[model samples]
Target: MKEHLKHDLEQINHLLDIIKKQGVEYLKLIGARPTSVNHIPLWETQNLPESGYGTEETLKIFNQRFEPIMVGSSGPRYLGFVTGGTTPASVAGDWLTSIYDQNTQSTIGQGDISANIELETIHLILELLGLPDSFLGGFVTGATMSNFTCLGVARQWVGKEQGKDIAKEGISGLIKILTATPHSSSIKSLSLLGLGSNNIVKVKTAEGEREAICIRDLEDQMIKLNGEPFILISSGGTVNTVDFDDFMEIKKLKEQYNFWWHIDAAFGGFAACSETHSHLVKGWEYADSITVDCHKWLNVPYESAVFLIKEQYKILQVETFQNSNAPYLGDPLENFGYLNFLPENSRRLKALPAWFSLMAYGREGYKNIINQNISLANQFGQLLERSNDFKLLAPVRLNTVCFTLKDSEKQDEVGRFLETLNDTGKVFMTPTFYNGHSGIRAAFVNWMTGENDIQLIFETMNEVITQLK
Candidate 1:
């Protein structure tokens, strides 16, 4: 076993050397391939001949089978779902985390390594988002779990005032959630929490507007409610174009209606770092709870997300998973339970990479990187406007640009052209639907992306459009 472990370590070290040498070039080569084909079977079986294979042979088979399934998120042009490429520091830290393989359920179990890293990461992330440090923060799996944790606490807070203990006795009465333009993930969270997504009352907004959820319509919805405690879910950034719902107006409605206000800032929360774009998410500080995914805009590796709440004790109220009579598990002074506030008991040490990234690049460094992405997005938007064949589909609010082809029949044609460009390994862009129309979408969330990358994307787009014409 020891000899096998040593060989595996050597292989990993060799792969790291190859990664450093090839850098972005190798990533571009891999990213230019089709991720999935329609005819490809979703499932395949590998038969074993009654005996287990040796370590090296097993490892080779594992890489051959699973490596192609991985997406090229590290590539500069991967703009599929507002996902960001991981930073160098964060990726290295992720390697270290895998090597250590420490479970971070309790402080005592891991000698406070997990707890201290989480705490430090929370402070750094809060500072980056311009949020108050007094709030309680916990590292969750991703934005979905973060939203679940925040909304769960919100449910508990409002449910307690109505003579019910939701944490112990689950939500019994009809709990209605209200949202102004709900992301699919938010709706999924609501459904998972037993608060049906269909039970949510939608607020109407203006025409040709990316920002849905009118404050007046929301107020009207609240007034009609029959004194049942309601939760108002506001959006910091819309999934379509990074459009921010008027949070200031939403906060006012929260005060008037007395509903728990929760902000879903999964993709755009990091925009708080930039002076120019921070106002887009104004009034975020007034939220009862906020969800941020460090893996998204912060450019950290996947599985690094956080949920922050204004009232620290509210988390403890909803998530104190402790029992008194455990023989070996209960230490009064140092005993920490895993399933406290988060839903999961045995949680991974996902915050290590985030903590390492923050330490390597301080607050100023983070702010600069975020601002650079915003600038790149603006440049891309300008280039789109300059093209006669392309039309801006939405306002480039932060780091996302949505544009469509001028010739309606050539919409899908343009998409195919973009795909061809990707196949040629020049740059990467994706397709998204805006206002019921197909268009190209580009999200600039990679730190390695710059003016040259933006120019390459636009050049490729121009070439593709011309060829289609």
Candidate 2:
């Protein structure tokens, strides 16, 4: 080993001690961290050094070059992109995930307990979401891959309906997919799955500011298929306004239609945590497959999401992802390994942070987080409605506030407004185009967000509007 590597090995405990202290201080000051900063990229970059920098020197170099630009996207005031702040337990677990660094694969026969721990995490999530044991789940990097995994199995099911093994035979026939306002990630998944993004038959959305699927129009689109099998991608919570489809009605349609049902619940599935909002996800448990993001609403670290497919589809899932060529791995059916279940063959113990979080918080803790976030969103929404300078784009449906400038002629100024507001380093939001008007979205999923934070957000907005004029 190099001298630097030798030194690193000798001082591992000292290095970790420094890291632990720094992490604690950072967490302590997380609320004070700037939500935005003026970061100009250096077009010029550096080449690799022949000799390694010691750990201490490297940390200093990183701090000088990159640490100042670090935005508090995980902080309470960060209202962009439905981001969630990590809890104490989750941060602790995340640190240990790197410390252990186990290759999580199998459960029983593989001689590793990591996969079993992952399985248990899935069970906990299912119970928290009021779902059933009939669903089998595993962790993926994020919602994009989670959608890819669930849709991969859905693709296999479609092929099986036509009496062909898609994983073996390849795409020889067209697959029908019907959806209204499907998330962009799902469309990306279709392209990745060899199903053309153009192949999706657009179903009409429900009336009046809702991104939910129109049940009657959905049935009409299904009628065009003439009893042929298709896939129905429904929304649990829309990205813009957090509108949810009528899952109960869709459950009824599933009984009559031959289509596979998939819900991209993502952050919205946490609705089950609130008695008032849980009805939004009613009948979601009956979905053939579901995608829930842990990083967004579960307040875990990044690169964590779970894809749940009904247990009955285990055969198709295995056929789609089975490692058939590797003989030493043994029969895929006999072993029941995770490697043959999802998109990635190799994975970390990604479930540990989520497991730690669930175990620490339990159902009641998450319930409080969900309900509190929803309430704070409403508080912010009312402020926007009362403000003379802003307009409410949609009702504060769940934990997101979709709005725009009140004056329609100021549409072009919206982008600059958001830029200036974010530059304040007090709060952050994302831009959107909704109902033919440019809009801004402020999503609240962070556990630390409170009524005072909502008031701070409005005050910041008011100042920005006044300065812009």
Query: Best-fitting candidate, measured by lDDT?
Result: 2
Against the reference, the lDDT scores of all candidates come to 0.74, 0.91
| TM-score (all chains, Cα) for each model | 0.86, 0.97
**Residue-level lDDT for 457 in candidate 2:** 84
Residues 1-469, candidate 1: write the lDDT tens digits: 5665667677876756655555555455644644332233355788873555545567567657765565566667676677787877887788788877766666555453566677677888888788887667788888898888887777787677688867677878777888877778778888888878878887786456657577677778888985667888887877778878788888776676777888899978888888888887888888888889888877888887898887554433334333322323333224543445467766677888888888898888888989998999898898878888888888888888888887777766766766666664565567778876788788888777778777767777778767767
- Return the TM-score for candidate 2, rounded to 2 decimals: 0.97
Writing each residue's lDDT as its tens digit, candidate 2 over 138-193 gives 99999999999999999999999999989888998799899998999999999999
TM-score of 1: 0.86
User: Candidate 2 — which pairs collide?
Assistant: none
Worst 10 residues of 1 by lDDT: 324-333
Which predicted model would earn the best TM-score?
2
